[model samples]
Target: MRQNPERRTALTDAAIEVLAEQGARGLTFRAVDQRAGVPTGTASNYFPNRDALLTQAGRRVFERLDPGPEAVGEALALPRTRASVDRLMHEMVDRITAFPSGHLAMLELRLESTRRPELRAVLTEQIRANLQENIDFHLASGLPGDAETVVHLYLALSWLIVERLTLPDLFDADRTADLITTLVARLIP
Candidate 1:
């Protein structure tokens, strides 16, 4: 594998784009190199095989989707109310949608993981950790929700995101935002 961290990240990111656009079958080293605009075989240097590339791409999508400290701080600052939860959910939707490729690649990875047990394990671990983090944040933030509430919100909002990303025309922007508010109101106490 190559020792250049930046190049490796770039290749992984490119792989994400390839996965998003072409699905797992279309993800090839040459395609990744072209997407990254690097010389041919560059991705192969960084990833020994397709599975390694796919695994790294899965990790990279989460890294790219991380909302960072600023967003977390902003969430914590909000009042602990159902309306606040609504606002937080709206912000979450906006944040996830902003990186369309990352979310779309995540969907692809979820599908691919079904065929590859190793990939399935990696995604399962990462997703479970992320879910736990969300649950912990909701509890610690004093948000108007328990762990179950958080889990329901997570499931609902995730499907909403899938709808928004895969079939955006199904719901317009205002309608989608309205749906988030409704979800928070109904799910939170």
Candidate 2:
């Protein structure tokens, strides 16, 4: 099929929506096509196989969810104080929790990775790169944590936010920001 960025983007988004709503099992070309409101073979024409679609869908989720370099630069430009860390933490949590659908799509990516080694390798590499970027951001911002501590704490906080935002039954939403604030206070100070 001819390469069309807009069409490909729509298809990838459709894949994420299907994956988020129905999980890996139901993430088929037909499902994406149906979700995208496109022709039956449209998704397959864009993505030759399941792995390609899954990989692109995973990438799309992160691309949509991550705060990116500009935001990181702005955060790092803030004064190197505990308050900066708190602000950054709040911003990160807010970005992740602001959209439950994005987190849901990411969860689908992680689960799909568990079932597919090919997908796992791709996800693992991307995850490592993202963590490194986050660590680099925090270190540059003078957050009082090494890469290991920063990443671990961030992951814990993120998991809490995701759980609270998407699966409120699993975790209390009322305490999430407080939990994040406390974690940031301890980790940064």
Candidate 3:
């Protein structure tokens, strides 16, 4: 059957929603079909296997979370100063908060990856690509860190963002802002 891009996107999106709401175990083709409100076998038509479906769902989350050129330009075009660092930090937090479900789905995928090495490898590649893209963006945007330092900073900020969003009661917005500000100060030189 000829692949329909729109339909594939729909299936992947549904998969993300299922993964977010129900975690990895609930991410069945039927569940995705139900979530998508499509006919039975619809998800299977797009993804022949569990691995394919899971991988596509992961990719879809990244696609949805990707900041387009305008946001990138706005962040990058700022003067490389302490205030610019603050704006960039705010941007990162805003983005992570904006897509809570996607981030949660990513966390689910991380846990699921541990049980399935194939899933682990797939996620590893995706994460590596994402990290490299961030590092590249950092270099282009003139963030103050070497490549290794930037990677570490990304990892740290990722954990903080995940924690802050997934457990809002644990850290109020002001505290989260304070944490981000301090981290940005240290990480951006």
Candidate 4:
């Protein structure tokens, strides 16, 4: 049976919202059906199975986050200051927190993919793309390799810090950026 693009889009959007608000572990066919204002039968008609639905939903999220070369250029173009870097890190954290379930779901997908070849393949591709984008951004910024390493470590730490802090209050964006800038500068000549 053919699917209506509009309906499929609606379902996908609905799935994202639920995943963001409720975490992947809490996602249910019935909840998505309600969120989409469609019947569970309709969702089943479109996705057919749990893994199928999750893969599609995860794919959509990953696609949106692809951060093409243009995005890398933008990141590189930003001033290399602690405030700027901190703001960037905070914004990323906000996004992850806002889409709690999607993040959790993706983590689950990552773990499951460890034993599932197909999923592992998908994850590998995504990780590769993401790594490339980061490398391009770092190189374009003209930062030294050691400084870039610090920035990478800082970024990971920032994510963990943001996860532990309350929304909007975890860290002052300007201050964080300033801190990153100072740290990076110290690493520089």
Residue 108 in model 1: shift from native, Å?
0.9
Per-residue accuracy of model 2 over 136-164 as CA lDDT, tens digit each: 87777676767877877767887787777
Candidate 3 lDDT tens digits, 7-41: 88988888888988999999998999999999998
Please identify which of the two predictions, 1 or 2, would achieve the higher TM-score against the true structure. 1
For candidate 1, write residues 1-189 as lDDT tens digits: 788999999999999999889988999999999999999999999998999999999999889889899999998999989988998889889989999999999899999999999999999999999999999999998988899998999899999999999999999899999999888888888
What residue pairs clash in candidate 4, if any at all? 23-101, 24-101, 82-177, 82-178, 82-181, 83-177, 83-178, 86-177
Question: Best-fitting candidate, measured by TM-score?
Answer: 1
lDDT of each: 0.93, 0.81, 0.83, 0.63
lDDT leaderboard ranking: 1, 3, 2, 4
TM-score of every model versus the real structure? 0.98, 0.91, 0.92, 0.64
lDDT tens readout by residue for model 4, 52-125: 66667767766655556776667677777554555555555555555555565566566657776776777778
Off by over 4 Å in 2: 169-173
Per-residue lDDT value at 22 in model 3? 96
